[model samples]
Target: MISVFPEVSSQYLIGGEWKTSSKIKEVRNPAKITEFVGEVALCSETDVTQAVDAAENAFKAWSRTSVDERAKRMKEAAEKLSTVIEEHVSLFVRENGKTMVEAKKDLLRCVEVMSKGADTLLEWWKPVHVEGQAQKVQIRKRPRGVTAVISPWNSPMILTFKRAIPAILAGNTVVIKPATYCPLTVMSCLKIIESSFPPGVINIVTGSGSVVGEALCGDTRVRTIAFTGSTETGKKIMSLSSNSVKKLYMELGGNDPALILPDADLNEAAIKRIRLGILRASGQVCSAIKRVYVHESRYEEFVDKLKKEFERVVVGSGIQPDTTMGPLNNRSQFNFVKELLERSKQIGAQVESIGQKLDSASWEEGYFMLPSIVTNLSHDSELVRAEQFGPIIPVIPFADLDEAIEMANDTEFGLRASVWTSNETAAIDIADRLEAGAVFHNNHTVFQNLRLDFPGIKESGLSQETRWGGLELFTDCYGFAD
Candidate 1:
């Protein structure tokens, strides 16, 4: 079947040029299973070395450039990105399996992060002047040389730019290894950047993570490794990176919780946030609201309201204008979600279908699944404790604020949380006590501020993004005393 969107060129960008090889991987549209969108070259170990060498050579000159110069280059790249918004968004929808609306938003977020680097870096770059006895001390920020960034398949473009933009603004050369499944979007973004920056400043390679990722992290010249993916893989990268003691920034998995208090506005606050949590990006977000702890007094009402609202979501191909949710990125993801739903059923969780299934005629071949809500599950159930990266949410009942807070903090992953309550003081009080790195009071946990720092506390990974603090992740701190 011919795809609604035409097949576009898909190739790797290394040292300011597009590359193709005899070995290419076909990229399929998740919404149209038979459609082949394009093909990407599978980088071998030699390609990985070449990309790394380009970045290494670029760092010598690029890292020495004034911060102002680097900022100018980044701002230009951001403006160039704006011109390709439609094209970039189209690629995101086709390659990453996100709805067109969501893709646009993600592209805009990437621009926001890149364009605001000047202001973001200024705060961290401020010279620390210390008046000491008989001498003066001033501390300055320095680049960490070449940085290797390995991004995941979900939200590929946004996460890739998140790490790359900051690293570049801090005057560090970056070598990107994007997930093979969604390298097209990142390659498109990199093409725009390559046109603006000098050769070797920014390079991209496409290949399996195990082969390409290990070589990049294990390279002695690569000074830092910023990764975003599964916790198990993150641990392996950490072990491999120990040889060089490369500076590391890991953003792993998350199992966020949303607590609904008895006094909360179920209609406005609770329902709206819950819908965003599980429904946004088809529930593929790391900080997605996977579990909900509702006050027993309002449990039934919350569940009913959520079901009605979830039913209103429209699922279709990401390129369609009316699509609010898209198919899972691939078959593995679809099966993983299906397995989780089945497990919930076996555990005696009350399973309820909330959204309409995709049209059997057009979408039958795609990796699609229905939106689901499970209730009456104990807090200790795996459904409640584990991260469900799908359109499934489990609702657990709590008797009081103490119990709600306890349940919210019970997980080993402390990435994000949300609390909904009518009382402003009570909401803020509870927000302060939540164990997660970020807490949303009377709102959902999906909101991310580009100027504010965003990261997790525990297993959710190390480091943050959006602010000057993130810029420091690509820099090395040095001390000098005389």
Candidate 2:
């Protein structure tokens, strides 16, 4: 039996204080529907304006601080994050419903991303000079005024740090609006930085997207918007910001594909990549492998091996140490996955479930769905074309390499793609041809490095998020001559 903890009310962290409003929204634990994690303060337009005003006021002092000073504060925040790692990880699991192991890894990744931002600050401050015949010219990057950061619920803590840390490190004050479904972890992160940062450097507001997001985007005080969510929503954000033409950075949806070639290692390659792409975050990840195109020669064997691997996953409450998977974040997502699964079946795709279902008598309260695999899908089927964002992998077989690449690039979304092959030269050739922001060879798209550029191409997104590229995203160029 899982023990329930006392319910805690969540509040907005604005100007370094926890403020509450009369309106509140209930936050539920997706693993056990009986448990209420807490309620978040439903912020009003006044709340959003206050948060933005705080950020705008702090911009002067924060943007004037030396890069080294900002880097030091960021490093301190990262260290503080490490000290409370276990607490945050436990909270993430309870609130977001990822397994304990997955939660810990996500926290660790947040720490790493924070530290990377600190390192980037130091590197970005390096002096640059250009020699000229008559005079010496120098170029430097300066912080943009105020930034509005909007993150999604899939991995709230990590994405929050990914956007906020870099923006702050680059000398920009931020107003963060984390996803309503998972705001506690982000608030906790804000508390850590609040202790180190000034009162108005990092301001957080919690509310429905319709109310708060529109206010932030519509406000003229905001200079830039960094967002991560669905493509349709991104379009709406773009429309909202058009009045002021605020600079935008968006990482949207992906229908990532992993192609299995005839020369690939049948056992190690297929199982490893599939686990990372399909099983991680229970397939809530934007880069999760939604479709797999296998060479006709090894299609059956690959499917059998993948099914066996999928069977080994233990799904239950996230706190269980042995749990390899957990429930989806909320009922809406649960219903979305179920509806998609049913739609795939109706479209003539073969669906298979692995492992034993936990007793519904006790576990039925939660929004749980078994990890599923759909096979024999047509190249143009909805399951293959759409972004399911669930733990369901659709396997499609192709006769030739050209057909496989064509099918991989068939989707309207092109966030990421991968190829599993032993031939290094052939893999490189295929990687160049694939339409994605990032490509993996002998691996899946889940693998990301801080040094490389991270962004989607075409409809996927418009900006990159690591190294110097990320720092420049929050900066504006100025020129002066005398």
Candidate 3:
């Protein structure tokens, strides 16, 4: 196998081996588009079929492998992952365009997610007992064959490994379909970690989602698909999987809200909203801070403070020292964000362009954009209603708490929201009303608590994940009483 740090391009990991294809796609560094990162071999539908076939064959034995053994192998993978983490850090910055701090956090978070799944698999995958008058009942969990993990480039490693590990721990084999733009990072990590598993147990097919993703989701042998991407793409996968009534685990888009109550701290709220909106993945995250709904009493104060903080954000190449954020990950995303900003102006939204570019000339060579703040937008405006997926913050003022809640819940997304206030009682009351899976009392975007459920309602996502629910997701429950 080639080194994790690729020179030009890398091969895919299929059936625990590196395989090649005739088609190759170029991967440019988003931080400096002129700099060639590498290339990745594109696989076809036949490759996806081969991967599913191998995973199906492997599942027969892997499913029966003891929990202790599976956990041990996963731990071994984690340890190996740490030893080579620096190489990953450097490569991640070059390929994905997230700052060094963000890249490091991404790597650590991925390890934490996978290790947590491995550590608790034995406890999470348990049989339940219920007593009755005549007979006792027991619920047993059974693996659901091969699981297809179709992961996106935004938080690629965390979402990919997090989705894949639970299914594998539940005794299901896995076929990974990584997004084309960031395939090398995932493929290299898998290359390092795949050694701990038996052949055919874990496989990956790299290519465009239109080809390989459809093939994996449509296959009858692939019983489950754990996906993390846009709601539109999730719908397509859902349709494809319906052919076989396959299980679908989706984490879709979000227009996440940050609401500031009348009694909120402007200093803290301003900083948190700015950081959450752009410092993370250039705001490409699915649950990023999308819209800000501040109490009209404090709207001007909050907006002014947020604009000042957003101005200081350091935008540059990811590998540079003291860089707070990096470029947009790809050309399509850059163009989309640019157009969104343009539309915000066309619709009469008050737009404030903020943020610093380290090298103004280098901006032309990279997919870089200074973060902008858009205010005075109606709830129905394109910038307010849609997921921009970039560093564009739309601040909308609400007259009362009820209006704030209404605006927060207006969207088709329910990933998360933040209620910034001092009073715990009011915070709880406000959080309870927001239509989202998780609510922060103050401000926090990305952190994992094993007990908390990471799910989305409405168009944001389907089904629940993390904690015990995640393990059960990969299994079909069966019980019988005598």
How close is every model to the real structure, measured as TM-score? 0.94, 0.95, 0.96
Give per-model CA RMSD. 2.4, 2.3, 1.9
TM-score of 2: 0.95
- Predicted structure 1: clash tally: 0
Q: Tens digit of lDDT per residue, candidate 3, span 132-234?
A: 6468878887899999999998878878887787788888999998888887778788877888999988898888888998899889899998999999999
Point out where model 3 deviates above 4 Å. 1-8, 268-270
Give model 2's clash tally: 0
lDDT of 1: 0.80
TM-score of 3: 0.96
Question: Model 2: per-residue lDDT, tens digit, 326-439?
Answer: 989988888888998999888788899775444556568787778888987787888788888888888988999998998888877888888888898999999999999998
lDDT of 2 at 151: 93
lDDT of 1 by residue, 86-111 (tens): 77777778877899888888888888
Question: Lowest summed lDDT over 10 consecutive residues: which window, candidate 3?
Answer: 1-10
- Each candidate's lDDT (Cα)? 0.80, 0.82, 0.83
lDDT of 2: 0.82
What ranking of all candidate models by TM-score puts the best one first?
3, 2, 1
lDDT of 3 at 212: 91
Q: Give the TM-score of candidate 1.
A: 0.94
Task: Give per-candidate clash totals.
Answer: 0, 0, 0
